[model samples]
Target: MSGSKKTYDTDTVVFGAGTAVIAAAIAAAKEGQETYLIEINNQIGGVMAASPGMMLGAGYPMKTSIGGFFKDYVQRMYNHTPPLARRRLSTLENLGEEVVYDPDYAIFL
Candidate 1:
């Protein structure tokens, strides 16, 4: 190995490409910041992508309305051509609301 080193500069560097981190990166980019997302796997979405057919729980326990990136993300899913996601109650009682979505569609979105 050579003694040379490479460094990159970015306004925002989000570790892991999970749903939350992806959202954070998008938010930063929208704010005109240079953002970078790093993920170990070839794909993003973390556990969501790793486990196919997984549903995202929103407004858990509180069941309150959620806004910001999460809300927008869900809206995008619903607004897709065939509707990539749907709002539903969790099978487990205390889990509150969930967003059931197609993994493939979610990744591309």
Candidate 2:
């Protein structure tokens, strides 16, 4: 990296789109500061993909116990994917409910 070539006149550049990274990006951007998110990989979902189960988890940011953007993101995932078949999965239902399988679900999901 060359210190000589400055990217922007404003002050902050966020790295990655991980949960923590997105939080920081949203916070910084909300504050009116110049913020940028740089993702290393083509994929942006981070650790969520590996875990399979999308949980708001403990200590997430939300008025209710669930987190904000994270919850919305997961819901969008379920909304798009078809319900699983047999009402059972190799793992627990990602949606945490019994539903038919969407054949192309995970592939496109």
Top candidate when judged by lDDT against the true structure: 1
lDDT of 2 by residue, 3-109 (tens): 68655666678887666687687778878988878888876645643444433333334313344654444455556534323323324333333323333343233
Error of 1 at 35 (Å): 1.0
What's model 1's lDDT at 64? 49
Q: Model 1 clash pairs? A: none
Q: Candidates' TM-scores?
A: 0.80, 0.48
Residue 29 in candidate 1, Cα distance off native in Å: 1.3
Candidate 2: lDDT over CA atoms? 0.51
Count of backbone clashes, every candidate in sequence: 0, 5
